[model samples]
Target: MRVQFSIALAHLLRRRRSTLVSLLGISLGVAFFLAVSALMRGSERDFLKRLVDNSPHITVLDQYRSARVQPAELRWPDAAVAISNVKPPVETRGIRSHRSKLESIEGWPGLRVAPVLRGSAVLTFAGQQQGVSLSGIVPARMKDVSTIDEQMVAGTLDDLAAAPNGLVIGQGLAEKFQLGLDSTVSMVTASGGARVMKVVGIFRTGNAAYDEGETFTLLKRAQVILARPNRVNRFIIQLADPQQARTVAAGIEQAIGYKSVSWIEASEDLLSLLLVRNIIMYSVVTAILVVAAFGIYNTISTIVVDKRRDIAILKAMGFSATDIRHIFLYQGAVIGLLGSCAGLMLGYGMMHVLASVELKPPGVSDVVHLPVWWGAEQYLLAIAFAMAACLCAAYLPANKAGKLQPVDTLRGAI
Candidate 1:
């Protein structure tokens, strides 16, 4: 085995140019794979972080997911008769008896729940009017469940509590209205009820739509403006472990009989899209390594052809066909091992360089660096994939060399 390995090493060193080319190909492929994977996975994680941070882990809405069964349908069991155009009974749009429902979920461990009343209102200022989403919240509870406190650029949620008529608006809205702190904005609800609220806070969330169209006020204030006093339509929930949101949301829905949606459920489509994106990205990057394998195959194949007489002489001197096969396989393994190591180093350097690069995105106030995830698993994956490709590439030539008859090869050489 040692003699076989030594011969393989000598052969590779003899064809240094071809060997170097193959090594370079494999190394470059592995390097690019690592760099791309780190960046992509890092970006994915960063995006999810922002998404989870900005939105509720779970939201309990005032509506039911399914329509209520009619008394007629309930009374007549197994009736095939179809009920058509059954208008559900008219009731108030907001959640009924929300206080009791909120009380029922109180004291649940690792949960922060805040009641909110969301409605659309038109903000009129300086003769300019824009429609905006208004959310009514308890400043104290909201601070526990929301990232708005961290995202606040000026003033605070507590300020809304201090002043009943205070409003929190996003920077985009503030800029659009050309208003600042203490600026008064006229808000008219869907019912034509109007209220004058002073802007006490401005927040920037880096999302244009939210920044431009979302506003917040005290829960009581929102009820008065929307003309549904003492009613709350939504409960925003944050969990200590966001991954447990689905289970908690289901439990909450069962407990309170309202529609509870987890962030995972709400963003299912986006998650699926990301999964598909990752699959495509890995497939494309893996193809580079697969292509690089061809270089190894060609180099090994050429060596096998060029070293036929040497192989024949070795076999004539009592070397087995298995020994010849091992020689070629060893060459492939060496190339794989060395190339993977060099590639990893290069990839790490690339990741650092990428992490250092900063770009100012449009409409963003601060420069952001590239996200690079440094997971050991990705390194293992790259090496495993590259080595597999190398081994597979080596197999064909090894098998062919192993099949060579010493007598036939010597006759050809002579």
Candidate 2:
């Protein structure tokens, strides 16, 4: 077997140019496959981490509200006219009874719920007006549902108590307003009333939507401004395992006898967007692999034709047809192994290049760098797939060589 392998190696080496071309094709395909899979996996992981870190795995809200947009304060001012345009309601209920249920929810296995009051308002600093989303939370309770404690860039929510009419703003918002922790900003409610708030803290979420629009204050204060006393917009639920978000969401809904949803379910459109991107990438990679497989088939067919005389001589010497087939099959396997190794290195190199560059989505300035995941499964899958393609490519030519009549092969014209 060793001798046969040695001969097969020499045969492949003899046609170095063709071997190199075929190997390059295979390597390119495998590299693309590896890189894309790594990118997708990394993006998914990063997105999930951000979701769980800044927000919650599950967010329980009233059945009447759509999860995509912020809660409304009231029925549209012109219900019939607004229904014609399908605008989100201006007013959303924030009943305190919903928050009162958190105690029972916290007792459930693998579940933690935090009450939050979120509403829209306008803030004026230095005569400049900016719209903001006001979010109210108990400092300790907020920590139970998110990484708010870690995201504080300056000051503390604890100071909110000392400074009545105090609020913690996002870094992005502060920068936009040119305000600081001690700055006083007057917020105008949707109802045209105004309240002055002392900026007690600033935070950065690295997400524009949140960091640009969110302002945190005591629930009692926010409720007074929004004119919804003792009511909350939503209950953020944290789970032990985010993977179990859907299951726990169902349990929470069952317990509350109301509609509820996980972050994944709430953000179906976002998930769908990711899914579409991945599908497109996978399709492109698959096409490249198919072309590489065809190249392998052509290379093996050429090899068969080139070695016709040798095959005839071996057969004449009583080498079985099965032995002839194994010789070529083994050659294909070696080609696959070498090409796959080269491909892995190529893929890793490309990932390194991507890591150095800053990439951001449109309408956002934050750079979301790509992440690399070097998984055992990715390596093993590349090798197995490449080998399988090569073996399949070799079969037709190898079988044809094995079936040739020795005399016919030997007497063949040039």
Candidate 3:
């Protein structure tokens, strides 16, 4: 094996140009694979972070996911009685007995819950009217679960608690209505009730739709203006570890009989899209390494054709077929090992360069740098795949070399 490896090294060194070209190809492939994977995976993580930070981990709505089964259906076991057009009774459109339900939820450890009465209302300022989503929140509880506190540009959520008639609005809405803190605005609800409220706080979330269409006030005030006293339609919850939201939401839904939605469930489509994107990315990048492998194949195949006499001579001199094959396979392994090392260093440099780039996109207030993920698994994966490709490429040539006949080679040379 040592003799075979020495011969393999000598062959590669003799065909220096071809070997270097193959090595360069493999290195470039691995480098690009790492750099691109870092960017894509990093962007995914950044997007998810923003989503998790901005919204509740779990939202408990004032509705049931499925219709209630009638008592007749429960009593009969596989009875073929069919009921048609069974219209359910009209009831109040809010979470029933919310206080007791909220208390039950509060008993759970590592959860922060804030009750919200979300509704729609028209805002009138200086004869300009705009419809916006009105959310009634307990300021103190809301601060614990939401990023609104951090996003506040002018005032704090505590302002809502201090002033019962205080309103917290987004920067987009304030700009549209030409209003500021301490400004008065009339808000009219669909229930034919109107109230003049004072602007106490302003927030900017950088999302145009949300910034322009959302406002918040005290829970009690929202209940009064929306004509639903002592009622809350939603419970916004944040968990100690957001990843456990799915399990926690299921438990809450079963216990309270309300519709509970986790962020993971709500973003299922986006998550699926990201997964598909990663698959496509990996396939395309892996193809680059595969193409580089073809270079290795061509180089080894050429060597086998040129050195048939040498292979036959070795076989005649008692070199086993397996030993001859190892000589060629060793060449591929060496190339793969060296190329992968060089590629990893090059890829890290590329990622560093990318991370330094800064740009200010449209509508954004500050410059943003590219996101780059540095995970050890990505490096290991690139090296492993490149080596596998190199080995597979060398196999055919190695086998051909091992099968050379001394008599046939001598006759052909003559």
Candidate 4:
């Protein structure tokens, strides 16, 4: 092994220019792989964080998964009765026995639940009217599951609790209405229920749609205005582990009979797009390394051709074909190992530069930087792929050199 390694080292030292060029190619490839992968993965995780923070992990709506079946069908088992043209009765659009439902949800491990009575209403102030999605919530319970508390720009949910008729609105909505804290506005529900409410809190969520259209008030006030007493239309839930949302949502739906939607289910199309984006990213970056591997192939192929006599003499001098193969393989291993180390250092430097950059996004008051996830898997992935590509490139030349016959070479030379 020592002799094989020395021979391999000698081959590289003899062609320092080609060896250096191959090393540079691999190092650049690896550095780009690590840097680009870290940036892309960071952005993906940041997007998911926004999705989880701004919205509930799971939502249990008042609606059922399927339409209610007729009692006559249940009573007649094998009668083969087909009922036609039956109109379903109009029922109240709110979850029944919501207190018990809330209790049941909170009883489950690692889940936090909040009851919300959401309805459409118009905010009329000074003869200008704008439509908004109004939500009634219990301040204490809501804080546990929703981000409104974190997004508040003016007052807290406790202010709404203090004033039963207090309203919490989005910054865009308040600006449109020219309203502020303690400003009076008349809220008219679709059910013809109307109330004079005061703006007690203002929030900005950075989502244009929500910022311009959503409003929140106390649960009791919402019930009174929406004409649904002791009832809620949705249960907004958060989990200790957001990844467990789908399973938890399924269990909640099965237990309560209402339609429960997980964040993953709600964003199926977006998630599919993310998966495709990752595939494209990895494919494009891997191509860079694949191109770099060609440099290794060229260097090794040149070495094999130039050192034909050397390989033949080594084979004649008690060195086996496997030993000859190992000599060239070791050359690739050396290049790959050293190149990967250099690439990792360069990649880390790139990440630091990216992390230092700050940008002011539109509609956001605070300055933010690019999200960069520093995880170990990407480093391992870069090294593994780099080594694999290098080894594969080395194999062809190594195999060719090993199969050469000393007698044929010496005979051709004469």
Ranking by lDDT: 3, 1, 4, 2
Model 3 poorest 10 in a row by lDDT:
76-85
For candidate 3, the lDDT comes to 0.94
lDDT of 2 by residue, 48-149 (tens): 677666768888775533344322325455445332345665665754477457777888887677788888999988878989888888777787777876
lDDT of each: 0.93, 0.79, 0.94, 0.92
Model 3 misplacement above 4 A: 75-82, 410-414
Q: For residues 133-188, could you state the per-residue lDDT of candidate 1 as single tens digits? A: 99999999999999999999999999998888999999999999998999998999
Q: Which residue runs of candidate 2 sit more than 4 Å off their true CA positions?
A: 1-7, 64-92, 190-194, 313-321, 358-368, 410-414
TM-scores, one per candidate: 0.93, 0.81, 0.93, 0.97
Strongest candidate by TM-score? 4
lDDT of 4 by residue, 61-132 (tens): 999888877788778856676876789778778999988988998899988999999999999999999999
Residue 243 lDDT, candidate 4, scale 0-100: 96
lDDT value, residue 186 of candidate 2: 88
TM-score of 3: 0.93
Whole-structure CA lDDT of model 1:
0.93
